[model samples]
Target: MSLLQKIQDLEDVLKKEQLTVDDLVAAISSEIACNSYLVSAEGKILSYSLAGSNSDKNADLALKLEFKQRVGFVFQTVANLPLEANFLENDNSFAPNTHMAIVPIHHLTSTAGHLLLTKKAQQFSEEELILAEASSLIAGIYLYEKANENNSDSQHNNIEMVLESLSFSEIKAIHSVFTELNGLEGFLVASKIADRIGISRSVIVNAMRKLESAGIVNSRSLGIKGTYIKIKNSSFLEALKLKVR
Candidate 1:
């Protein structure tokens, strides 16, 4: 199969597995031919993928980022760092660590989390960025789906609980709008969300807009057919498992 097709196949697996951030990090590291992959969520290691067999990874790498720095600045560096940027761009890089990429994940308006991909500096190529970004996109979809599922179960759940680092309001008032809602009948309209929420048409419209932006639901105009919203992804328990892994 073509490279793009292989990538797409990986995407399908990611979607099917409800691939967590950790899964994608492994996929990225393996695909990029990198030695190891380390991912931080809010600075703490969310996942790690070692390139070759290593008895002790921690004892081997001398260079590392501060716990706090890894979460914020180091990751920010990955996102903003330009093409071909090396060692200076991310302290996570040292000799034998040639390639690296940082990505920022955001759903709706707020930042969801970050992803980092590293290869030996000498080993990285532009294609790695493509691979990394593609993985990030898939990861974003996975997280977005998880966030929407969380919303269904919790009254105050607004954020997707990425990395356990994010903080937000209960969205209690906002959620009340949908409290009375029941599976949209067939598919709920803006009016239903607005009426149940006891808000103005504009407010309901705005809420749906935000929810759609977060990929919690999908909205489509039937044109002459009808306009409706479809719930995005179900709960983690209900999500499909792509493979045995």
Candidate 2:
């Protein structure tokens, strides 16, 4: 079935009755013919669904272990919203050419967790990518409500402080860098950001400097080639997403 049709069917089921996080994981996995995991921002597994025997029969202990080892990597990749399919290659733990769709589950503006979907197949279609993103957003909202119910005032206060640290321009730069993350591009340079936002290179560099001081981005010089920049952590992207929005 098409990805859109599968998503519509899932929505129908979701509307019929509330499903626990685990139930949602299983349903998403089945609909997409892949293994699905809901992991906390700190890389704890909240729920997971193993592909059925008829599907991806190689979903074995080794595969699970591989995912365990790479869960942090997965979260880091999708900490920013709207990321493309990340192709994990040359990892003996998984089958050759495994594709992982990493989606950040946000709470309000901050990322509370991640949804990781994996299949031993080629790249996912654009339709599948859209479905994965929508599923993660749903999961994020559910998790956000759950966290709010359990969190103390001090935690919320701390999060607010972090959100207030960045200026608007810095947030935009971070957002632009995150939106471009894909298999083809990893780290972004200042010039790229300048061109993307129609701002001057100097202005972009100044923003990056502030972001670096805030520990949101890391930069390095390549001599004549100029400097390249990257987000320092996934959590920073989450916070920036919340602040910028």
Candidate 3:
């Protein structure tokens, strides 16, 4: 809507919804106060309240968004990474206005989405850069909140997929016994791992007949009781811990 029309609509919505414009404006105004610009999670124009906004040159911001989106898919494939993992800096070019960061809305350690600063000039002062990064962080958190509110089905599916991948019956058989592991320290035979996983000795030997089959545990002999060591999967084992937690 045009500015005048938006004002009228805001007035109508506030009256109809029994809310306040300050409540709406305060959220947008906060970004304006910080960086003079704001963007939607998809990098669309949410606002360019400040006159000097370089939103037109937000390609750097756009690339960062794409990178974050690709990595954010990890929410479906991996466990929650610590804040410091994905929250690290991209590039420190030191161009004040052009300085930007990608902040993702993440919950349960998975990024649901992110937002970017709308614009900047050739350079941003340290203060402006700080404000831009802070604003991006705020936008990320807000987007995550909104996605959580809306995408219950997607999250549910992800949770189920995670559980299934982690609990593949054959993989679980090893995890069930990893802590109590028994193996040849000097040169035990491979039969021990088979015994631990509850498969017959011949099954273990014959299992290696095929390669790269899922749900089959692989083993290698090192030495002593640790010789025949069971290897379910490094990545899957790690994923299991993540999903379990």
Best by lDDT: 2
Better of 1 and 2 by TM-score: 1
lDDT for model 2 comes to 0.63
lDDT of each: 0.50, 0.63, 0.40
Best by TM-score: 1
lDDT tens digits by residue: candidate 1, 1-245:
45697577657666555566556666666666664344334444555565654444443432235434644643233522322433222345345434456766655665556665555436455666666667666766776776677856662243243212211221322343334334532344555555555656565556556666655557776655435656554331122111111
Please provide TM-scores, in order, for all candidate models, with all chains considered together.
0.47, 0.45, 0.29
lDDT of 2 by residue, 215-236 (tens): 6567787766666566654555
Q: Stretches of candidate 1 above 4 Å error?
A: 18-21, 35-41, 52-97, 121-123, 156-245
Q: Model 3: runs farther than 4 Å from truth?
A: 1-133, 139-176, 182-190, 193-198, 202-245
Models sorted by lDDT, best on top: 2, 1, 3
Report the Cα lDDT for residue 239, model 1: 24
True-structure RMSD for candidate 1: 13.1
TM-score of candidate 2 against the unseen true structure: 0.45
